[model samples]
Target: MIPWVHIDTGTIPNGGGTLRLMRRGQEFSIQLGQNELMNSRLSGSEVALAELACGRIAARSGARVLIGGLGMGFTLRAALQTLPERALVEVAELVPSVAAWARGPLAEVFGGILDDPRVRLLQTDVAAPIGAARAVYDAILLDVDNGPDGLTHPGNDRLYDHGGLGLARRALRPGGVLAVWSAHPDAAFTRRLRDAGFTVEEVPVRANGRRGGARHRIWLAARPDGAR
Candidate 1:
């Protein structure tokens, strides 16, 4: 067995805690403290996050997407694959080092997706773009902070709260989708999505997809057409 190597470490902005990058041969992992946030070998759910959301808006001409986290570029790469040539994707990553890791230690895992013509990487909190936009995005895909129940950043809770859901609803174009990836299910959060006026679907997927791994949940919340 190849022993894991500690490649690098980065501090999360706004006192979010520290992230450690680890590798064992070709396998890579990004972790916060004892919790592993992402791994190269387990990209199935992350891929689903993009495929499921992009599938919802595939018919929209020149679709625009906002991805809340840039971990390993699984969702971005999947989104680029699923979206049309004219589509544009904006990826917001709050931690600077995560972006750097994508370019540096995890470059092979990212496969140069950062330089894609449709990709625009924003090194800031995803909330900044969500709050600034109005019916701007065709889809907003959030794989941030272990879903609504965050572990690394306390501030990430706002993205799952009532007001945060409201902002997301406003930022999305009518009929657009807000897809969120979670390590676990939150029935209350599902209720919140309904209360926020979104047509919600809770999907249970394996971390490793068909091969089977830990069960995870993805919420596909669609902003109804003509919704304010």
Candidate 2:
């Protein structure tokens, strides 16, 4: 059997962990430790989540979208293709090394989209934009840290909490959509979305185009019209 080569990427300040890119022949994986974060193996669900998020907000002009995490740029690219010319996308990525990899080694995965005019890639946490903004974005799509139940960073757990959900609610326009991609479903989290004053719905998605394989869940939440 061929060995998987490990390449040192860099480190994250907040997490106090080193980033490594592992490659074995045609397959590539991103890992913070023993746990695998994302891979090139399956991305159909990611694409579908992007589409679902955009569909709810594409009706409006001058749409402002915030994409949490820029994994391989599949979500961003799909959004760019769906949104109008007047639309803008701000992608917040916590790890600078992941951004570097997208632009440097894994450029082919996104076809030089790191430099796309529609995309504003920030090397910061997604919570920053979510907290700082004031009812600006029409859509906020988050695929960070697997899901509400899965915590990649101890701090990321807050993003699923009431406070973080409140921040996300404040950052979005009235009737705006909050779409989250998860590896699986969490009923408790769905209830939390409703408690946050959002109309929540769960959609099961597969990671195959016509031919299905692994299944994932996408949670769609819409802020109330009177929600501030």
The top-ranked prediction according to lDDT is: 1
Looking at candidate 2, the ten consecutive residues that score lowest on lDDT are: 7-16
For 1-228, candidate 2 gives per-residue lDDT tens digits of: 878888657676576577688887776778877867678777788888889999888878989999998877888988987888888899998888888888776777779876767788888888899999989999999987777843656677878999899899999999899999988889999989999889998999987745797788999999888877
- Give the number of the best model, judged by TM-score: 1
Residue-level lDDT of model 1, residues 205-226, one tens digit each, is 9999899999999999999999
What CA RMSD would you report for each candidate? 0.7, 1.6
The superposed Cα distance between candidate 1 and the true structure at residue 179, in angstroms, equals 0.5
In model 1, what lDDT does residue 206 have?
Answer: 92
TM-score: model 2 vs. ground truth? 0.94
- Taken over the whole model, the C-alpha lDDT of each candidate is 0.93, 0.84
TM-score of each: 0.98, 0.94
